[model samples]
Target: MLADTATIVARLTEFLGPDSVVADPVQMGSYLNEPRKRFHEKAAAVALPRSVAEVQALTRFAFEHGVALIPQGGNTGLVGAQVPLRGDEVIVSLARINALREIDAAAGHMTVEAGMILEEAHRIAEAEGAMFPLWIASQGSARIGGVLSSNAGGVNVLAYGNARELCLGVEAVLADGRLYKGLNALKKDNTGYDLKDLLIGAEGTLGIITAATLKIFPLPAVYETAIVNLASPEAALELFYTMRERAGMRLNAFELVPLIGLDMQMRHGMLDKDPTAGPSPWYALIEISQPKGAKGGLLQAGLEAAFEAQLIDNAVVAESLADRTRMWAFREQMSEVQSREGASIKHDVSVPIAAIPRLIAEGSEAAEALVAGIRAVPFGHMGDGNIHFNFSQPVGADGKTFMAGAQPVHDAVYEVVLRLGGSVSAEHGIGQLKTALLKQVKDPVALEMMRAIKQALDPRGILNPGKMLD
Candidate 1:
């Protein structure tokens, strides 16, 4: 039931003017290409709506004319959710609709248009003497809408929580061009069904998010970060418990990084010097925030106890801002460093915090059994139990050959994740990548409710048709 590309582009041009419509396939590359570079389907056209009214007009036209519209933000998403799947849909980029509407530092929230970049949000908060705790690596390019849409969780999720928790409410344009203004900064609203949450992580299937009121916090007085050496995930697990019991909410990040990660970064010249104390099988990037009027050395005290308990053998606390930045770079550059080693298979899976040790040990063993000499690079938010389980190809294996057998490796990891009551897609939403896996692992009742919600909200199936549900 899709119209021809030329007709669709012409109609969209009439609806939003030629400046807003991009019909040329060559010009559409930027909107079509996503982070993974796995999907290649071209969109019919890209529409840049500069205002909420323009977005409504386009959505109404799509609903009435039976056109599929894929809502996109910064297009930095890894799961191909913001990009097209069928090549018949039009991409509705919110880049132009970006505008700040309100700010209330006292209430700990601010409203910004969907098009504004994530890092800009951080700057805005800091200008008001506040802090927006979400800090994803792609903050420079990822926008507020896409971050909320994906319900992104960065290194600080252990402290401030994910995008969903940080978001108080959102303004969205539902299918058929109806505006659903639900923006509110209330701390307690026992309202009927929570619609804000439904659209936040819906991947634009339910509606297109236009703006949101996001939570902000008072800027912390100091951040104490460190790189600690551990023998195994079990040792890291014990250290995590020790630190969490001592620090509580003051603990911001507890990331896991394998010794291989460090070696790769150094060989690729990504790091000038090794951040860890010395050679250990694994390392944990532990960090804590010292609020204003709060005493320092909290992290040092916790690490001291850990060392005494034999949970950690050695550590190096960041003494300067430059040192803290280097320590974090070692953790954030994990994905990029993998490419230097050639072919890699990655999984963003999470398990119950207590079961993390088993998940890593068993998942690594299974991957090795599937392909010998497979270098396991399992690391990530150890405190939150979300490990970026990844593996590089054998020492001299062919890249294409190893990638060809990535499915079994993925199956192996997901098997361990599900067995431990873990999630296959944590932080990153199930874009087109894991739709099949979602259906297989998700509870049947949850699947039914998701389908019912999608059908109810998007009756004609015009908004992101064939995505999440399909």
Candidate 2:
């Protein structure tokens, strides 16, 4: 039998002090409001667990009482994974558990509590003369647990990989309140199964991540940055190949930005000045890391080669740190600039590197045919083959009406993505937003395997009850 809300709050307050348990709806607003504003379900109460032990205790109580427990971090997830789906569920915010447990610069690893902010982790790594490279726009507010849960990928994915790759191991609270002590700095571990991998990206459906051991790397001495003008996606692809052949793993980022993105930023005054080489149909922001004692200007030489080969129309290499920052700002601000235009339908999808050109061409054409006057804004990590395929509503259209018509546009873009052998979600995982889409697009056998795992691990369905499944 389900406990009354008062009884639940009373018991929680008894276990964890009254300071940690939030019962008032108004006080729970911070935890309830997600980034997208798409999910609007109210949680029964928000519990701020101050330590790993407290997290374990809360999980134990929820497991025994059969109360749904939704694990939340900084509440900055683009998908609704960090928020509640069921109104009756209790949200366990890890914010109070923030702590940097250990840092072993010699071993190239750091142990951080789940609630530690992503930007804080970067600072810790930098202080120790190392780097933790999993970066996202929401790093200021996104926490380590949520970042690992989503397995976030940002601009540096080409060089450093995603959160899963950076994470060495995790300490999670299982469905039964049993602690899984998986954190370690060891580079090699051949266990029976990869449970760490399972929990990292499970989005709290499998377990609650409390702390993790993450890999760190030596900070690069400098970065060679450039923005190259391309005639089309095909030309960008050719240029990407040239850079990959030349720089190999040192090629940190190769981002694609359309002409419209620059126009939007300039029109909205988001940028102080145009950060491009005159006008071009498309542009590719490329960066290469120069390790300590390594030579710089590798990117400039590569661009010179491309120019000589007629692969690129024109290019502007960053002459100073200010120039590099402006170049990156132009790339990162692509998503935010869309809101200035109007209602935008977005899809974070990826295809094979070679197929990215086709994915963009076909997806754009399909979306335009479906919604007349729709502005296609296809851009993102070209090196990793992930494109943030977004569409702004036609000029002078109502945002609500345009958003209401997003279903068909989504189908059209996803169809092309599927045909290109790409993922429906690249960096962003399937939260409540895409659970049905996941069920439809995911293989039946894979779905069955996921269901079996969910059943085996969270048999009571007490952890994140309605997310990533149905």
Candidate 3:
């Protein structure tokens, strides 16, 4: 039998201390309120363990009593992974366990506790003249543990890989309270099985990540940025190919933005001034990093080549630091400006690099067919073929009414993604939001393998119950 709310709270308080437990629902707002505001189930209590020993004790107690524990970090996740699925579960927050364990700047690696904020990690690495290349919108509040658990893929994924690639090792506590100390700085290890890779993207269904050894790089000398005008997704694809062939690995980011995004941001007063050269149907934000002893102007030359090939007509390269900041601000704020417009239906899906144009055209057509005047605002890491395909309600439509019919819109988009041999989720993991969708679309054999692994690691289903596989 499962434990009740009072029992769960009392057990947590006894394992840790009264100071580490929050039993009052009114004071648990921060832990319950996720970014999307979709999941509303209240947790039994919030446990803030200060060290690994405390975490192990709490887990052992929960396991013995058959209590469900949800591991959370920073509470900034988009899906309901970090929040409670069942109302009686206890949330084990890692916010107070943050600490820098080790750093080897010369060897290009550092180990940090999972509760450390991603922005703070970047600061520490930069202090040692090194850098972590994961750049996401929620880095300010997103913790290292959640970032690795979700296997987040940011804009720089075109050059630097996703969170799984950036991490060399991780330390996690299994469901039975046994610590899996896998932290290492080795570049090559021919082990029996890659358990580190398994836990990184399991969405806490297998184990709770405590700390991670992350890969760092030498600080770049300068970053060349720009916003280029494109006729359509086809033209942007052509430009992306041209830029990649020219800049090669130095190409850091290639993001796609629509003209409607610019208009919305300008109308909402989100931007002080226009960042693009002029109005066009679509725009691409391309950037390249220059290392020490390397000359700049790679972005300018690539744009010049694209112009000559008739792929782009006009562009504005960042001439100063402020220009670069403004250009990035425009790209990163695409999702926020949509909320100001009205209710929005969002999808974080990916397709092959060559099938992006088709994905956009067909997906937009299908959504518009379902809901008239549904403004299709599709934009994201075009370099990696992952687009944040979203739709805004018709002007002056009731927000709640439009959201009520969101399932048909989601079905329309996912159909197109699957038909094009793409993924239903790109950067975001399969949290409670997409559990049914994953079971429906995922291969039968693959799903069986995932379940076997989950059972092997967390036999009691105590770690993050009802997430991912459920």
Candidate 4:
């Protein structure tokens, strides 16, 4: 039998105290409102568990009652994974559990509670002469659990890889309220199947990640940053290959941006001045790390070679900290500036590195063909073959009307991505947003495996019900 909402609230208050259970609707806005503003379902109640035992206890109650439980962290996920799918679900926000368990710079690892902010993780590592390199625009508010749950990839993915690669181990509460004690700093562990990897990107469907052990690296002595002009994606690809061959692992970041992004930032007064070297059809923001006792100016030399080879038009090397900040601000603000314009259709997809040029060219053409006067704004981690392929609707089109026709636009872009052997979601997981797309594009055997895992871990279908799988 289902437990009454009143009874559930009373029991939860008794166990966790009234201060931890938020029953008021107004006070739950922060947990319900995600970054995209796409999902609008209200949770039954917001539960803030301050310790691992509290989280385990809450899960036990939820599992017994057959009430769906949504695990949330920082509420900064671009997809709706950190929010409730069904209105009757309970949201367990991990914000209050923030704490650093241990940090060993010599050992090259750190253990942190899932609720710790991403930026705070960075600050802690920096204080110990180490670096945790997972970076996103929302790092100021995004937590470690959500970052791991989504397996976030940012600019440095070219060098450091995504969250899953950086994470060494994870400690989570299973669906039946049993604790999975898996945290460790060991580099090699072939004892059995990798359960940590499964839960890290599962988006809370299999388990609730309460804490994790993350890998850290020594801090680089300096960063060589530059904005180089490229005629097109093809030219950018050639320049990337040249830099990769020369700088190797030191080549940290390589991002692509279109001319319209600069125009939009200028019109909105988002940038004090143009950060590019000069006008071009596109720009590539490249950076290289200088380790201690290593030589600098590798980026400048690579740019010079590209210029000699006619691969790039021009380049501007950042001379001061302020200039470097301005260059990065231009790249990081791409997603936020889109809302200022009007309704926008976005896709975060990736293809093989060699196919990126064709993917962008063909996808952009198809979108324009579908909607007359539609502006295409394709940009992002060019080095990793992941492009944030977004399109702004035709000037003066109603936001609702434009969004109503999203099916055809999505079909056009995804068809091209599929043909190029790319993923429908490169960084963002299949939250409520892309579940259907995943079903359509994913392999049959892979889908079966995922379903089996879900069933094995959550037999009652209570954890984040109707998410990724459905």
Tens digits of per-residue lDDT, candidate 3, 354-420, equal 9999999999999999998899999999999999999999999999999999999999999999999
Residues 1-470, candidate 4: write the lDDT tens digits. 35576677787888899999997889999999998899999878889999999999999988888878999999888779989887888899899888999999889999999999999999999999999988889999999998999899998899999999999999999999999999999889999999999998899999999999999999999999999999999999999999999899999999999999998888999999999988899999999998889988899889989999999978989999999999999999999888898999999999999999999899999998989888899999999999999998788988888889988999999999999999999998898998988899999999999999999999999889888999
Instruction: Give the per-residue lDDT of model 2 (tens digit) for 73-176.
Output: 88988779878887888999888777999998778999999999999999999999999988788899999999999999999999999999999999999988
TM-score result, candidate 3:
0.99
- Which lDDT value does model 3 have at 69? 88
Show the lowest summed lDDT stretch of 10 residues, model 3.
Answer: 1-10
The lDDT values for all models are 0.92, 0.91, 0.93, 0.92
Query: Tens digit of lDDT per residue, candidate 1, span 81-137?
Result: 999898899999999978889988887999999999999999999999899999988
TM-score of 2: 0.99
Evaluate residue 35 in candidate 4 and report its C-alpha lDDT on the 0 to 100 scale. Answer: 81
Error of 4 at 287 (Å): 0.6
Best by lDDT: 3
Evaluate residue 79 in candidate 1 and report its C-alpha lDDT on the 0 to 100 scale.
Answer: 89
Candidate 4 has an lDDT of 0.92
TM-score of 1: 0.99
Native-vs-model 1 lDDT? Answer: 0.92
